[model samples]
Structure formats: C-alpha cells, structure tokens
Target: MMRRPGLALKLSVLLMLGVVGAMVVDFSLTSGTDMDRARVLVFVSIALAMALLAAVVLDTLIIRPLVRLSAQARRMEDRGYAEPFVPTGLDEPRELGEALEHLRQRVLAEREELQRLNAELERRVEERSLALAAAQRALVEGERLVAVGRLGAGVAHEVNNPAGVILGRAGLLLDDAATPEAAEDLRVIMRQAERIREITGALLRLGRPSRGERGAVDLAAVARSAMELARHEAVARGVTLELSCQASEVDADAAALEQVAYNLIRNAVQASQEGGVVRLHVAGSTLSVSDTGSGIAPEAIPHLFEPFFTTKKLGEGTGLGLAVAHGIVRDHGGTLTAENLPERGARFVVRLG
Candidate 1:
C-alpha cells in the first residue's frame, strides 16, 4: 500500500505552494515601479506566510491525528486487531480513538465467534455420522437376534431330546455308586454331560437380548482367553492361529467380549484355505483378524455381518458367526468392519475405544 504522507511534509509543501502563488499574484497586480514592487512583495509575503503558518499548525494539531486514526482502522481491518494509539490531552481525538479501538475489539470477538461456530459444526457432523452408523448396526443386530431366536427354537427342540436321555441315564448311574472305579468314571461322564447342558444354556442366553450393565473390561485378556478355547478348531483346519496384541482395555462385559473374540476367530479360521494363516493382531486400541483365503466379493462386503448371510457352501456354515460378532462389538461400544485385503484375502478390523 502507498504510505500516507506525514503531516510535516504535507504542511511544508502546502505552505511553499501558497507563498509562491502569492508572490506571483502580487507581482502581477503591482505597477512597474521598484518601490511599489518591493512594498507589494513585502505585504503579500507577510500575509501568505501567516496563512501558511496557520495551515501548518492546524495540520499538526488536527489533520495528523485523523490520518493516524485512519491508518489504525485499516490495520485492524486487514490484520483482525491490534492495540490502538490513544490521543492525549484532546477530548475529540481521545473519544475518536476509543471508538476505533472498540470497533476493532468487536470485530475480533466476532471473528473468534465465527471460528468457534465452525468447529462446533464439524463436531456435530461427526457425532451425527457415528450415531447414524451405530443405528444401522443396531438394526442389523436386531434382525440377527430374531433369526437366532428362531434357529435356537429348532435346535433346542432337536437337542433337548438327547439331552434329557443323557441326563436321565447319568442320574441312574450316580444313584448306583456301587464300585469305586465305576462311580468315578460315571461321575466324570455325568459332569461332562452336565457341561453340555450349560453350553446349550449359554447359547440360549446369547440368542435372546442381553441385559448386562456397561462396565470396564480388558480386551486383550478377553481375546487371549477366547483363543485358548477356539484353538482346537484352528488346528483341526490346519490353519495357524497367531495373536499379536497390546495392552488395551475397554468399557464392556468380559463375557461378551470373549464371545466377540470367539466368533471373530472362528470366522477367521473358517474363512482361511487349508494350511492358511489366521492372524489376530491387536494394535493400540484396535483388534484385527486376517485370513489367507479367497477374499469376500465386493458386493458381499456390505452384507457379511448380517444374519444368515454366508459365502460358504450350503451346509458348511450357519452364517451367524459374523452377525453375532457384530452384535457383541456394538454392545461393547465398539465397531466391526470387514474388507478385502489388497493382495488376496479378507481382513476384519475391530476397534474398541
């Protein structure tokens, strides 16, 4: 920007021009006489000089402060705000300076307010997105529970018949307790038979909606414990079960988290081709399961976690593994996402924060 002329320079230029003009006019009006010319020059010079002096004083006292105030305003407009100069010993300029400073402060406050509003807007957008995603997941889980209830009804009816026979026969054996050896073996069998009942009961609980309170739990520990239970299946399938974990905790049920890990690992093992690697890696606060098998089709990625949605052969899978896994993660305040790996496989990333 062009620098404004200083008051001293402006006043000096104005005064010089005025004097020169007066000299010219005076010479033009005077008669062609040396004495008259000298006298006219003196009078004109004096009058012009006094007028120039007055102009200088006014500029120093009035015009300069006005210019400084203008510069202060422009600076505030361009740079948001800054400390302003206060005019001393003058009512008008002091008042004007205070007004300009107030204006600058107001503009600065408004600018800050605008920034705050923008940040708030972004936060709300993120919250809405998370809520929408959570609601959609909830809907999918509700549908899965409904299907599980139906399947459990059928499975219960089928399995309960045999369970009743096994329980009845074990009770009869226990009643005998004739030989020490026979009783020990019978008791062992009876206990194992009773365990099957417990498992079926647990499955029934899972098929129904859960009523557990939220609480803090350790995800890494839960995952490791679940692995101990599911290791046999991975071994049977000739797939390696590997876990890379970190110290991580979350607000969730320990049992539900175990179920989630169980479902995820079982699915990973099943998804792998024979002799494939099923890696369970937990980093920071997220758990990931990856398998070396044919990746899920792009079309199926979106529906993989839905109940009864399966990519396996007709009888190979019940398809409730991923659906149940999804529910478990949601109930624990987390997320489950599946994607096709870059090379040739599927990876599921579960985040708990």
Candidate 2:
C-alpha cells in the first residue's frame, strides 16, 4: 500500500527538514511579530503524517518479509530432508534454495547405492576365492598319485635283477656241494639269497602292487630296515650313510614305509658323488634324506614330486622315485617334498600330517 521503505524514509526525512525550514522562513518573512503560526502548524502536521507513513511501509514490506524468509531458511537448514520449502520470490536466491534441497536427495541415493555395491562385490570375491582353493587342492592330490605310480615302477625294475642273480647262484651252489669248505661256501650263498629275498619283501610291503593287499603297516620298523639295506650301498660308494635316527613308529602298513625310505635313500644316493655324505634324519614323526651331490635349481624343486619329472637322463631314470614317496606318504596322511641342499645335492623331506 505504501512506497518502498528506503525511498519513503528518505522522502519523509527530506519533508520534515523542509517543513522546519519553511516555518523558519515564513516566520522571518512575517517579521518577528508575524510568527506565521497557522502555516507552521500545517507544515508540522504534514511532516508527522509522512513520518508515520514511512514507518508503516518499512514494517509491512521490507522488514516483515525479510524476517519471514530468514525463519524459513533456518527451518530448512535444521530439518533438511523431512520437508520442502515454500516458494519465495524469483532470481538467484530462489535457485539456490531449490538446489540445496535436491542436493540432499541425490547424496542420500548415492550413499545407499555405494553401500549395496560394496556388499555384493565382497560376497562374490569370497566365493570365487574358495572355489579356487578347492580346485587347487584336488589338482595337488591327483599329481601325488601319479608320482607314486612312477616310483613303484623304478623299484620293481631295479629289484628284479638283483633277485634273479642271488636266486640263480644259490640254486647252483645247493646242487653242487661236495666238501666241508664247499658246504660253508654254499651256506654263505644261501644266506645271501635270503638277504636278497628279505630286501624284496620289505620293498613289496611298502610298494603294494594292484594285485597285493594293503594291511596294517609298521612305518618305524620299515624305515629301520631300509636304512640297513642302504648302509652297504653307501659304504661301497665311499659315502657315509649318516643315520640321524631315533626310535620312531608309524601305524602304516610295513611295506609302504620301506618304499618311502628306499625312494628317499635312492634320491640321496644319486645326489651325492663318491665320498660325499648322505644324511638320513628321522624325527618329528617324519624323515628326511639328504645328500651332497649337485644342488637342484629352485625351478626344478617345485616339480620334484611330479611324475616323470626327473633331473636325471631318460635312460638313467624314469623319474618316479620322489613321486612314489609323495603318494605313499600322503596315503598314510603325510606329505613329501624335495629341495636342493644349501651346500650341494637334493633333500627329500617327508611328513605324516
């Protein structure tokens, strides 16, 4: 209803001053006795009316609207997401109000989506990781079986020749005995034959063929027997068989333990050169066969228990020795590993888990 407060206030102030000056001028113009009292009263009344009008305009238009808008802004800041703001006047200020409200909604939606995606991705990664672990375990078991099969072939192949020699020689001596000294020679031949048979028997106990039955095995006794058999071989090669052994036992079938020992010893023997030492350390409910010959490469060590993976030449070996030991150990709830010695040669470590 009234003019703007700033403009009205300025006009009111100017009118008040002009009225005072006009009163002064009229009084001066009428001389000291004229006083001009009626004109002065009219000017003063006009000034008062303008001042009252200016006060009304300030309250109704500028001051009251600003106070209401300020209260709305404070309410929106305090309770942002719960409600929408009332539409105010247009311009940059109006756009700012709308943008603030929409910004809250967008932030809330993005926060929710981010949490959901993080959970989903974490779940998928865990599942994939478990599957990979299971597959890796299966692959390792299969490789172990293949290794055992190859070692079995080497033992059978090497054993057959020695058995035939002892058996043939003993049979001839038994048929041709003719004197006391000859009889003693025949006795020696007979004993040698028996020893050879015992060796094969020990091996058979540890290396069960498809046609054989696996029964309760004594692993400790079998290990001792294998150490006995390797002793002579080590001496003949000018190498000392270091038996770092203590009394130990296993519930495995006796035959399998012998083969495990045999495979380990054989690898140790091959690793060492003449006069080099091979250590047969048995403890911790486990056994280790080590030799000082040629160290294995790091790359080769990983595949040492793999079937047909031999550092030996094709003609010299079939690469099943360590593999067979690994399989047999696993069958007895154990593990087998091969590595190069720090100084020289390779070491076979077997453990029954």
Candidate 3:
C-alpha cells in the first residue's frame, strides 16, 4: 500500500520549492548587476520568513490543539467523563470540544438513570419470584389434601356397613341382657359403635355433594344451635364457648350451615386447653371460629381440612370434622379457610356469598 505524506513533510517540500524558485530568479536578475549579494540576501530572508510563518501557523492551528484533544480523549476513555473538555485553539477545535463535552455529560446522566432503573427492575423481579413460589406451595398442598380426602372416603365407605351391623347387634344385646353388668357392657359397646357411625357419616358428607334444601337461613341462629350442640363437648373439655356477634342471614341450607358451625366449634373446643375460650363470630355473610389454644402446627396446616388428617391423639378424633365442614361450606357457594392466630390458637373463617 502507498503511504500518504504527513502535514510536516508537505510543508517542508513547499518551503524547499519556494527557496529554489527565489534562487533561480536572483541568478537571472543579478547576473549583470553588482547587486547580486543584495538579491541573494533578500531571497534568503524571504524564504526564511516564509518557513518560520508556516511552522508557527501549523503549530498554532493544528499541532498544539490536536495534542490537547488527543489527551482529553484518552482521559475520557480511561477514567470516564469525570471532567468536561476545555476548548482551545481555533473556532473549529473549540466547537468540537464543546460538542464532545455535551455528549459526555448526556451519556453519563443516561448511564446513571439506567442503573437506577435496573435496580428497580431487579427488586420487582425478586418480589414476583417470591409470590410465585408461595403460590406454587399452596397449589401443591391443595393437591395433596384432595388425594388424602379421596383415600379416606373410600376407607370410610368400606367400614360403614360392618360398623352399622355391630351397632345394631349391640343395641339388641343391650335390650336382652341377663344382668345389669351385661346390660352396661352392651351399652358401652353400642356407644362406641355409634361413635364409629358418626365418623363414617362425616366421611360420607366429605365425599358426597350436599342434597339439602336451601332457604333463607339466619346464620346467628345456626351459630346458636351449633354452640349448644358443642356445649357438652366444651364442658367435658373444660373449654368455654362464646358467641360474639348479632344476626346475619344467607340463602343456604340451614342444616348444612348448622353442621358446619358445629364441626368447627367442636374442633376448636377439642384443640383448646382446659379453661380456654372458643369465640364464634357471625358478621354479615361471614362466620368465624377463633380458639384460644396453641396454634396449629405449621406442617399440619396444609392438611388440616383433609379427611383422616387430625392433629389430635388417636381414638380421640376421626379427623373428618373440618373436611365435612369445608365441603358443606363449599356446597353452599361459600369459602372456608383456616389460619393460625399471631398470638395464640387458630381461626376458621366461613364466607357465604
């Protein structure tokens, strides 16, 4: 490839041409005159002055400003736009410097703003990720509870006929007992068999859809009846049941609602410590049972409404209470949810729409 001549080389060539032309003119004009020395001096002086002027102009207009601008560009590349460009030299160079300065400032401002926006975007992403994780956990728990309820329903169905037969025979034996002790023993067998029937009934309720008739039902009255039904259990457990709200009505099956409230209140009483209180709250379209006992176990919360998933000791509970209650509420076009209280115990809320 051919190399181009630099500015300094071009200037030097022009100066040499000027000197040669001046020498030729002097030789021709002063060859017949005694002013040859004067002509030579004049030519030399003019060439020297032209060379000096060219050097000064090149240095002032191009070389010095170019060096400064290069240094400024290097500083910006190495350390970023920490300082503004200071213009020097001719108008063109000064305007170029100003333009560069403006661009640097704008770029720096945009970069900072972009950083801020990136930080905000990251925060939002983290929040959404946490929410998604929580939702996934809830969905998994719901699926597991459904699976358990289906299994429990099948087992309960298989055991129902045998339990009914035992209960029937025990009732017959109690009536024909030869002695008082035999009658008492037979009575005990019948009572135990009745408890089994109750459990199987709850399981059937959980597994099947409600066929109860719907009517305008007063929730407060239902709550009262539920409280009365649970009164004996509460007294046995030494727990107090309290009603804390006025009348509320909904278009639902009164028996279903009553059963739901009875199950919830009974479970609360059973979970409570002796002398603890279970409060029943009935507001417009909502009923809640809050118990003053140790809150539910964190690991058990997911399975709380599942049939046969009980935190109570074996033989003390059949675990179908909340499952049946949940089904009943759902059949009434309502929602039932349970949560642990912050300070103590647990709360079950039913919303009728």
Candidate 4:
C-alpha cells in the first residue's frame, strides 16, 4: 500500500523550504553590504528556530486533536458504546464530535430494543410449538381408543360363545370325575374358562355404550358400597381400607358409578404392599382411591388405560380393569385420571357431576 504524508510531515517540509528561500533572499539582498558570514549564519539560525517552534505549536493545537476525533468516530462505528464519549477540540470540531456521540447513543438504543423483541418472539414460538405438539398427541390417542372400542365390540361377541361352551363342558366333566385329582384338574379348566368368560363380559360392557337410567345418587354412598366389596380382598392381602364419605349427590348411573368405584378400589388394594393402607375419599362429585405402595412406573402411565396394556405378571392381571373403568366414566360424561403421588403410591380420581 502506498503511504501518504501526514499533516505534520507535510507542514514540516513546507516550513523547511520557506526557510531556505528566506536565506537566499537575505544573502542576495546583503551580497554588496559589509555583512560577514557570522551575522548571516545568526540570521539563518533564528529563522530556522522560529519555523520549528511554529510547526510544533500548530501540530499540537490542530492536527493532534483532529486525529483523536477520527479515532473516536471509528470506535463509535464499531458499536463500542459502553465507554462515554467526550467531545474534543473547539468550535466546529467540538460540535462535530458531539453530533457523532449522539448518533452512537441512538444506534445503541435501537440495537438493544431489537434484541429484546427477538427474545420475546423466540419465547412465543416455543410456547406455540409445545401447545401444538400436545394437541397432536391428544388427537392420536383419541383415534386409537375409538379403533380399539370397535374391534373389541366385534371380538367379544365371537369369543363369548366358545368360552361359555368350555365352561359348561368343564363343569360337566368335573361332576363325573373318577378321582379327586381328575376333579381338581377339571376344576382348574373350569376356573380358566370362567376367567375367559369374565374377560369377554368386561369387553362387551366396555365396547357397548351407556344406556342406563341416570338419577341423583349419593356419591359417598356409592363409594362406601365399593369399599365394602373390596374389603375382603384388602384383608386377604393384609392391606387396610380407609373410607371417608361426604354424602355428595351427583347425576349419574348408579350401577355404572358403583362399578367404576369398585374397580378403582380393587386396583388400589391389589397395588398396596403388605400392611399398607388403601384410602378412599368421596367429596362433592369426586372420588379418589389412593394406595400406600410403590408408585406407578413412569413408562406405564401413558398406556395405563389402554386395553390389554398391563404392567402385571402373567396370570395376575388381565389389564382390562382401567380401560373398562375409563370407558364407563366417559359414558357417564365424566373423567377418570390416574397419577403417582409425590411421596409414594398412586391415585385414581373420578369426577362425575
């Protein structure tokens, strides 16, 4: 890159040339006088000293301040507004410096406002994205449950007949068994067939729509009846059953509500550990069943109410309990929801009004 002479350098060169021209003029004018070499030398020396002093004063008062102002402008252009800017020099230079500082302040304010707006936009977008995803998940879950209901409605009808026939044959063979062992074997067959019949019956009930009469029934009374039914199972499992009823009335099918309450109570009882407590609470239009046992598995929560989705060991649970309970609650124009307690165990809440 080619370098240009600075203000100071150019002024110094011009002053030197003027001093040499003055020396020529002086010597030419005094060439015929009695002036000697020492006097001429003294005159040249004085002129040279004055020229150097003038250069130093002009550079300090004018050139250096202008150079500093240019550097400040460059810093402003780069958005270094954190430091306060002070106008330098006098007259027009000071005014120009003040104007540059004002422009820098305005730019800084605008940039800060833009950044705040961008952050707000991002937050809103994230909230909308989360809401959209939740809605999509709900849509898919609804479609899946409807499909399962339709399939179950058909399968239950077909399975019921064979299950009944097996139950009948096993009962008949048991009555005619020659040995106790044979009778016990036939009884096992009967028990298994009976289980199949119960499952088909539950499926049929779940797939069928609610058509029962609705009336004002006491929610507390219904819950108490359910607790009584589950009392035997709780005792057998060494779990305690505690019931708290508030005598709240609600418009619902009495039989259906009783079934839901019974299912929830029975599940809670089964989930409780030995010597653990199962609590049933009925207040207003709500019924909650809580058990003091290990909390529900997180992975099983999403599919907890889906038909045939169970966390139970084989031969322990058919997994249709919660599915059927959920369907019954929906048919009653109510809701059934399950969640794990913070400390321990799980809770099932039924709301009907």
Candidate 5:
C-alpha cells in the first residue's frame, strides 16, 4: 500500500509547484526583455520568502495542534483522564480540542457513577445474605429447643407408667415375701424395667445426629416395610393404603430410612378420613406420601417440621414423629417437605441426594 503524505509534506510540495509555475510564466512573458536576469533573481527571492512564510503558517495552525492532541490522547489512554486537554491554535483545531475535552469529562463522570452503583449493589447483596443466614440459624435453634421439650415430655409420660408398675410390684413383693405370688411380682418388675429401657433407647436413637451405617439400601423394600407397619392403622381407620414404587437404591442407613418412611406413611394414614386413600409413591430417591383428607391449615404449614406442632389430638400424637423424620432425612443429606395438595389433602415428599 502507498503511504499517504502528512499535511506538512503535502503543503510544501504544493508551494514548490506553485513557485515553479510562476517562474515559467515570468520567463515566457519576459522572453525578449533586456532585464530578464534581474527579473528572474527578484522572482526567485519572492518565491523563497513565500515558501518560508507558508511553512510557518502550516506549522502553527495545523501541525502543532494535531501533535499536541495526539499526545494528550495517548496520555489519557495510559494514565487515565487525570490531565485535561488544553485547547491551542486558532480556529478549527482549537474547536476540535475543546469538543474532545468535553467528551472525556462526560465519560469520566459516567464511569465514576457506574463504580458507585456497583459498590452499592454489592453492599446490599452482602447485607441481605448475612441477615438471611442469621434468621435461619435462629429458626433452627428455636425448633431444636421445641423438639427437646416435646421429647422430654413424651419420655416422662412413657417412663411414668412403667415406673409406677415396677414400684407397685416391688411393694407387693416386699409385703408378701416367701409367697408364690412374690416370684410373679419380681418378674413383673423386671418386665416393667425392661419396657422403660426400651422407651429410652428409642428416644436416643431418634435423637442421634449422625446417619448410621451407610449402605446401598433398597428404597422399594423400605417402602414395603413401612406400608406393612402402617397397614393395621390404615385398616383400623377404614382407609385404603396404596403403594406405587420403582426399585431404587441410595447410600443411607436402612433402619433410618425405614423409620423415615414409616413415620411419613403413618402420619398420612392418620391424616386421612374414613373411606379415604393414603398413597405412597416412590421414584428414584424421592418418596411422596399423600392422603385424601382435609388439607393442612395454611397457618400450620410453616411450623409443620417443628417439634410438638402437631394438629392431632393431645393423646393421639406426641408431635415428635415428623420432627424426628425430618432430622433423620436431613442427616442423610436429604430434604423432607410437607405441602397441601391442590385439590384436597396434604402431601409429604422426601428427596435424598
């Protein structure tokens, strides 16, 4: 590609061409003049002066201002908009420089405003995240205390009956020593103590935080067992039990999974009305227990997973079943949620990851 000449070079070339044309015209017009040589000398001097003047004019008006503007642009690119463009020269170049300066200031202002907005956005996000985390922690702690209170009450009630039996039998034995009835009394005492031990053991197991003895557990089998356990309760309530499950496996404790399934199924059965149906559906690692009965109260949905927040009658439920099931599923890296069905009744879904 042919390189384009700069302004200065092009102007100088035009000046030289004009001078040569003038010399040719003068020589042609004064071809017969006796003072031709002097005339040529005068013409040469004037041409040289004009050329020098043109060079000065071009340098001052065009060349210098453009060079300055280019340097200012480079500096702005390298060091940012700290230095402002100072207009110089007369006429067009100066006007152009002023326009560039105005544009630069506007851009800088917009950039600063953008940075401020970005900082504000980040601050708001962080604040919301912290607040959300704190709220979640408080909610979890509150639920935990409620669970403890319910467990304590249930334990006390369960232990009280067995304790009374043991104490009464011991008193009878003391009153009738060496009697044939004393042996039977001793045996009854032992049986009541064992019952108390079993109740405590169950509580301990439910309260345990860790998922016990992980293995590849067949979810279909667990669902079957849970259904079988709840079958009697469903029958007693005149409710039908329906199961739809595909064979699926998960890394979990078989006993823990069984407990979760049983608790959920039993709750569904209890929630159902006479002649209603409780359906258990399992697909992959997800299980849903749904019942055709009155849907859950909207207000109670939020506290459904909380301990001692049951809607059942006082004697019918201790309110710890769902809480225990929730904890067990959580320990196994899963989630359990309850939601009222669209048409009627409620559904409990468990998803294991």
Candidate 6:
C-alpha cells in the first residue's frame, strides 16, 4: 500500500515553496536596484515568520482535530460504546466528527438489541431441551408399565390356584389339630395363605383390563364418594379433608373412576401429618388430590405407579393402589400424573376428557 503524506508534511512543503518564491522575487527586484544585504535578510525573516504562524493555525484548527477524531473512531471499534465521541475544531472537521459520533450511537443500540435477541434465543432453546427430555422419560415409563401389566396378569393367574389350596388345607388342619401349639401353627399357615390370596387378588386387579361400561360419570360425585370413604381415616389421623367440587362429567366407568379417587385420597390421608390438609379439587374433568405431607422422595417418584414399588413400610402397603389408578386413567384415555408441590407435599392430577 502506498502511504500518503500527512497534513503537517504537506503544509510544511507548501510553506517552504512560498518562502523560496519570496526570496526569488526579492532577488529579481533587487537586481535592478541598490538593495542592501541587511534589507534582503529582513524581508526573508518576515516571510519565514508568516509561514510559521500559518503552520500553527493549521495544526490547531485542522490537523490536530482530524488526528484526534481518527483516534476516537479506532477506540470506538475496539471498546464498544463505553466512551462518547465529542466533536471539535473548525466547521468541516467538526461536522465529520459529529457524523462519526452519530454512527457510534446507532451501532451501540444495534449491538445491545442483538445481544438481547441472542439471550432470548438461548433461553428458548434451553426450555425446549428440558421439555424434550421429560417427554422421552414419560414414553419410557409408559412402555415399562405396559410390560409390567402383562407380566402381572400372568403371574397372578398362576399364583391364585396354589394360594387358595394352601388356605383350604391350612384351615382343615387347624380344625383337626390335637394340641394348642399345633392349632397355632396351622393358624399361622392359614393366615399367611390368606395374605398370599390377598396379594394375588391385588395383582389381578392391577393387571386386569381397566376398560369398563362407559357412561357419563360426574367427577365431582366420584370425588365426593371417595372423600366420604376416606373421612374416617382422615378423622382418625387428625387430618383435614378439603373438597372443592364442580359438576364436571366425563365419559368413563363410574366405579373405576371412584376407585381411582378413593385410592388417591387414601394415600393422601396416610401420607399427611396430624392437622395437615388433604385437598381434593374436582373441576372440568380434572381431579387433583394434594396432601400437606413431606413431598415424595425424588428418587421414588419414577416408580410411584409401578406395581409392588412402595414407599410404605413392609406389610403396610401392597403398592398396587397407584398402579391400578394409573391403569384405570389410561384405559379411560386420560392421564394421571404425580408431582411434588413447590411449597410442600405432593399432588396427583387426573385429567380426563
């Protein structure tokens, strides 16, 4: 690239040319007259002073201001809009500086807008990522539940026959026992057999086809029935049952829906502390049961609706309640979801249409 001469150098060259011209003119005019050497020297000195003054004026009004303005533009490119560009000097340079300053302001505004848009895009992407992950988890869970149901149905059928036989034989032995210890032993065997039968019954229920006679069933009424059934347990536990029902009807099996409501309410009652509130709200084909207990454990939430997956103490729960409820809701072409509340406790929502 060719480097151009700066304003200072160009002005200096012009001033030197003018001085030479003045000296030449003095020599030419003096050639025809008796001009003294002192007089010629004085005239040359005056020309030199005028050139110096012109140089000073140009530097102050044009050269120095243009240099400052150029430096300011470079700084603006490097450092963003942190500094203001102040216009200075004579009309032409000042106008140019003002134009550059205006450009800096516009660029700054555009840069800020671009930054805001980028931030918004990032936030939306993050949200979509989270939603996609949740959807994948739900899909896997649904497949697992289907497999569990098929297996449970087969297992329950196979186990039911032997369980009944054991109970029958134990009962006969208990009646024929000759000693108190023998009778007691037989009783224990019968009791265990009875428990086995109960377990098998629950498994069958969980695995059975949930679709039943469909009718217009008012969810509020079903919720009210469940609330009544749980009223005694709630009272015994010193838990308050709060019901807010709307006359919302859904095409579903009344008995199955009631069972779902009952199971959810029962679980909520059992989970709550004394004096804790158990809220049952039914509105517009949606029923939610919320309990003011310690929220469900995060690790246990995924398996909450899986058969035999219980958080309750051993022997206290068969763990088929939620599984059955989920199956019923699914068969009704609805969804049953459980979530921990932000403040405290857990909420189970059943949405039907």
Per-model clash counts, in order, read 0, 14, 0, 0, 0, 0
**TM accuracy, model 1:** 0.49
For candidate 3, write residues 175-224 as lDDT tens digits: 88999999999888888888888887777777663668988889999999
Instruction: Put down candidate 1 lDDT per residue, 125-235, tens digits, no spaces.
Output: 999999999898767666766677557746755676687688789789878878988888888887766755654554454465245666776667877888888899988
lDDT of 5 by residue, 51-120 (tens): 7776667667766887799888988877999788888887888998999899889999999999999999
Model 3, residue 168: distance off in Å is 2.2
The global Cα lDDT (0 to 1) of model 1 is: 0.72
Query: Tens digit of lDDT per residue, candidate 6, span 229-297?
Result: 989999999999999988997899998888899899989988899999999999898999999998889
Ranking by lDDT: 6, 3, 4, 5, 1, 2
After superposition, the stretches of candidate 2 with alpha carbons farther than 4 Å from their true spots are 1-220
Q: Candidates' lDDT values, in order?
A: 0.72, 0.65, 0.80, 0.79, 0.76, 0.83
Q: Which stretches of candidate 4 lie over 4 Å from their true place?
A: 1-136
Q: What's the TM for model 5?
A: 0.51
Pick the lDDT winner.
Answer: 6
Provide the lDDT at 186 for model 2: 75
Stretch of 10 with least lDDT, candidate 5: 16-25
lDDT of 4: 0.79
lDDT of 6: 0.83
Pairs with steric clashes in candidate 1:
none
By how many angstroms RMSD does model 2 differ from the true structure?
Answer: 13.8
Off by over 4 Å in 1: 1-44, 53-113, 129-133, 136-140, 155-222, 225-240, 245-259, 270-277, 281-298, 326-353
TM-scores, all candidates, are: 0.49, 0.44, 0.60, 0.63, 0.51, 0.73
Cα deviation at 12, candidate 3, in Å, is 34
Candidate RMSDs in order: 12.8, 13.8, 9.2, 9.1, 13.3, 7.2
